[model samples]
Target: MKIIVFLGPSLPRSEAASIIDAEFRSPVAQGDVYEATLIRPDAIAIIDGYFGFQPAVWHKEILWAMTQGIHVFGAASMGAWRAVELGPFGMVGHGWIYEAYRDGRLEGEDEVAITHGPAAVGYKPISEALVNMRRTFASAADAGVMTVDTARQLVQIAKRQFFPKRDYEAVITAAQLPAAQAADLSHWIRRHAIDQKRRDASSLLHWFSQNINYLSAPKRVAYQFSATVFWAQAVELKRREMLSRYPGRKLDHARIEQFTRQTMGNADVQCRQQRLEQCKP
Candidate 1:
């Protein structure tokens, strides 16, 4: 069996512990959720429920998994966006394909699109959903005419609530509501979905700027905190895997931290470029 580590969306310490403990040899050994620091597991997976709203953060992990040859997948919000943006990495989700192209990572000159909205959760590749989402967004954008900002917000709102077969209509309903009403509704959805774009970037940036916050500060802090948690988990996994390899060998902690930092540094740089590109006209 492939060893997968689910990351993102700060789960309750107890809930995260349940998944990690039930699945890994030591769930709370070093208090981390990622399995990479200590073990070169055969495969790793991520749950979008954790990081679906934060696109920048989600992309880093997706790219990291892809580059490392790990099979990565996402479910909603962050997952839906990545399933399309990093489809080259292979994924599964619905909606956000247009935004993926808007960011410039998902490019298929061939218009060969696919839709399996009615399939089982793990059965369909997210790439198919991306194609379908593109069409849906295009229609939603053009239907009954709306401001570009409204359309943009609609796409953003759709990211978190987008489900393969079940919640698609709800996504559309939310997307089609007047921009003002939709804004209020987004707060409710974001509890389980991330649609930061619903609030104009200018307003958000303004609020941050007024408070002397750097553009990257919130995202960076989130990255550091989550990465630290993941690193800790990975270290424990590595130690145990090493023990399995060498019956009584003790594992090294410093080496794991160094390795995790190096890998994360590379992901940070790449993700920075992605965020910059997404802001381009």
Candidate 2:
């Protein structure tokens, strides 16, 4: 069965590959899923995805993929969010993070957001996710490392900070706990902090491995895909982008022009050209 996983800082690619053999791509961004659909993989699993710094994967493209019979699974960070939103549309969700979002226990993007290094360095996380921190704090409290009240306080503090600035040290320090308690909490976290996103991502990979046979068949969905003008434009753009990567390949400019004219009227084309020219130096 052919499967593709979109992954990044939620878990190391090596670790994920160890759990399941699949084509692993970097964190998904806008147009990435549309590109994936062109390959017609039996299934696509989303673990991590780009947001804040890039255009996020569109829900429409995912729906389109499902309509095309590609099974889509979501978990971990961005995947969890997308799954919760698209669950009714036949996008499968897996693991604790997905459950939390689906059950409405989690409500914000910041819950999974974290600052991370580039892919060159393996997408190393520089900031902690609020969800992981919440889990860690709850675990610590349950273990008697801190009071439940203290854990709640820490969660509030972590939530207050912007996602990129949220980290263990920053949240603990801002809590202003006593020296001994702070020390204990810090030590406990070093040894026991729960990486909910990573765990969820690992679970997703394993689930995919186990379900490979069942997932080999195309997915069936009740809803019909509506190809709006924007979707057509997106598909054309993705097509051109893919073609551009192969220098030796020829582009069907005549067909592209015809498609452009059909999807985007002459006036819209002129307006877009004007805007592009205005941005030129």
The 10 consecutive residues of candidate 1 with the worst lDDT sum are: 213-222
Candidate that scores best on TM-score: 2
Model number with the top lDDT: 2
How much is 199 displaced in model 1, in angstroms? 29
Per-prediction TM-score: 0.30, 0.89
Model 2, global lDDT: 0.86
Q: Give a tens-digit lDDT track for model 1, residues 1-281.
A: 33443432212224344433223221111212233523544443333232222213335444444444444444323334445665554543323433454467455422222222221232133332333344444554455334456655655554544243323345547667766655544443333332222111122222323433222221111122234344333344445666687787665656654555655545543443354234222
TM-score of predicted structure 2? 0.89
Which portions of model 1 miss their true places by more than 4 Å?
5-37, 51-58, 88-252, 257-281
